[model samples]
Target: MVLHTVNCPPSHPALGQCLRLLAPGDALLLLGDGVYAALAGSRAAAELAASGAALHVLDVDARAAGVLERLADGVSVCDDEGFVALTERYPRQQAWY
Candidate 1:
């Protein structure tokens, strides 16, 4: 499974491209402004839910945005250590900035 990191807002074209390119079992890690997509009741969140990809968001970023508790179900919040672990697990990363 691929580990895909997106660091931009959901409105960005890269986010759409990333979603289109994802294969089954791929993991998506949202960082920076990308964490907005993990919020509950969002169109992006809905799309993500339908994609069947594992979803994660940076804990720090979500906290900063004041939306940690509002994150969609099945989305995980991770710290820096967890980010490193994801990198180690995937062995490869595709970063969309």
Candidate 2:
């Protein structure tokens, strides 16, 4: 499955559109302002979890958003190395900035 990265906020329509295209086994990496989606009850968070895609939030971004401690159960927190690994593991990547 292709790996997708969304670094935009929930208010961005692109985030929703991107999530709708994801399927199980796909990956979504939330970075930049997108870490806000990691908030437990946010709509973006719910949609991400419901889609069954592997959800990942950048550690630095999550901390900057002050949501590192409030991320949902299934969201994985990743560092730069992990991000690099994701790029290596997935052949295709779609970035939603």
Error of 1 at 31 (Å): 0.4
**lDDT of all the models against the reference?**
0.92, 0.91
Candidate 1, residue 51: Cα displacement in angstroms equals 1.1
Taking all chains together, each candidate's TM-score versus the true structure is 0.96, 0.96
- Per-residue C-alpha lDDT of model 2 across residues 1-97, encoded as one tens digit per residue: 9899998899998898888899899999999999998899888789888999999999998998998979988999999999999999998999988
TM-score, cand. 1: 0.96
Candidate 2 residue pairs in clash (backbone atoms < 3 Å): none
Best by lDDT: 1
Residue 29 lDDT in candidate 2:
95
